[model samples]
Target: MKTNGKKTGSGRIAYRKRDRVAYLYLLPWLIGLVMLQFFPFFSSLYYSFTDYKVTGGMNWIGLDNYIRLFTKDADFHNSLKVTVLYTLYTVPLKLTMALAIAMFLNRDIKGINLIRTLYYIPSLFGGSVAIAVLWKLMFLDNGVINAMLTALHLPNIQFWGDHRYALKTICSLEIWQFGSSMVMFLAALKNVPKELYEAADIDGSGKIAKFIHVTLPQISPIIFFTLIMQTIQALQNFTSAFVITNGGPLKSTYVLGMMLYKEGFAYFNMGYASSISWVIFAMIVVVTLLLFRSSSAWVFYEDEEK
Candidate 1:
């Protein structure tokens, strides 16, 4: 009994020592979470309720910032409208183009790896300020696109200069970065069982029919994931609008992110900007929840089948 007790005590000491080592390894991450993530998260929430200025003091103002945003701020409503419209236009267009290109690239062919790499290159630089600036220059009066049009004896279109085309130009810029989505779709496509396609072939299914019946259902989960991600990204888009149009020919491209930047840094309305940030966060959460709720009707899982 004495020996057994000693063994048990040794085991407990070993377990405690292992736990201490594990915690030591986790210490840096915990410190970072507290200092960087958790602190800012709660501080932002507190700031939202106060008239916090960057230069100096803050006074508790309750929900005045949020209330004013909804009621008094016309830019808030316009930014919301533009954000929703941008999400609606860009997400679908980008995902459709991605899936289509993914399908084409999924086939076994020569130089296919090089083709995939080339297609994926755009996504790497898609959100960079430099890319946004280059895009703006390319859409300018005598830029590459207009130059090509002129060379073809076609009238040049004012891409970023006109209000009607400004938002669409940004959408096009986003859709051009469909490489990430394409890569995801291609991966999902590769995971789909070949037996399913063989069975569809046996049934004399057409290409479209096979895709609709076999391919889509199998990859529905990935599609749902991409849709949710792209929607959030579109809502948070800032660079293109900031660099290309500076929120407009007529505030037509002023997304929520751009508005938030202008409010926080440009205008130095820190408290109001915090409120706007919270609103944007809430909107993202609500939309994500809605998408998750709707996903049950479409998204398929192998585990669910099992």
Candidate 2:
């Protein structure tokens, strides 16, 4: 059939028409990308180079905000230390636990879907204010965790109260969201060939041996991807620290995100906050590139199957 002098699907015209319809359907997303994401990106770049405040006019200040952060700001140093520590600790622990749990559940088990749902429940509220506030209660002096310690005849630990363990409390909140990462790893693990494991078994490989020889190699790409992603997420983490600790115990848990918020919202220093955001963006980019550079040594693909 032809209309308005247009050709039919027998020609390349039909594919182009389908593409146009697909683009049309994607028009809303394109608009939102430009409006919500693209515009803010450029705006942030501009703001980072200026002396803009939340309630004041913008004045171009070049790299002064960046300079102040590195050289003149003690609090920036503190926040950076806390954030780096948090990221380092949380990422590996979460990934390891998640991978372990996912591998365990990957077997032939009844109600696996239900178990998955149960595991994933914490992820749904990982960043919610309500959950973080509730976390504050959970880490209190007489909370569930401490009560368990007491029952075990160990000293009741003060989690969020002390500078020593406040970071640990926040990490638990971060690690609890491992379900999302676990679900991804589970899917990737399932995609690993059963033939590979069978072959390993024929070679007299035990469970641990098969896991090291077949499973780790197959899942390395997913592991690397989640590592970079979770690092980025943890670097920009705000709500948990904000709600649970409020950067408490001498700002021992103050992440860069909290510093940005305090500078922009609390102190009306938008330019400094924007500068901080850009620094974070650059840090994430650098870390991601480093991981990508190192991935060729470890991350395996079937295309490069060896």
Candidates in order have lDDT scores of 0.91, 0.90
How close is each model in CA RMSD to the real structure?
Answer: 4.6, 3.9
- The residue ranges of model 2 lying beyond 4 angstroms of the native Cα positions read 1-10, 13-23
Tens digits of per-residue lDDT, candidate 1, 1-306, equal: 332323366787976666678778999999999999999999999999999988869999999999999999999999999999999999999999999999998988899879989999989997899999888989998899999999999999999888888999888889899999999999999999999999999999999999999999999999998898888888899988998899988899999999999989988889989999999899899999999998888888888977
Off by over 4 Å in 1: 1-17
Error of 1 at 217 (Å): 1.8
TM-scores across all candidates?
A: 0.91, 0.90
Mind giving the per-residue lDDT tens digits that candidate 2 earns over 1-306?
Answer: 654544565656766666678778899999999999999999999999999987889999999999999999999999989989999999999999999999999999999889999999999997999999888887799898789888999998778779998988899888988999899989998998899988997899998999888999999989998999899999999998988889987898999999989988999899999999998899899999999999998888888846
| Per-residue lDDT of 70 in model 1 | 97
The lDDT of model 2 is 0.90
Q: Candidate 1: global Cα-lDDT?
A: 0.91
**Colliding residue pairs in candidate 2:** none
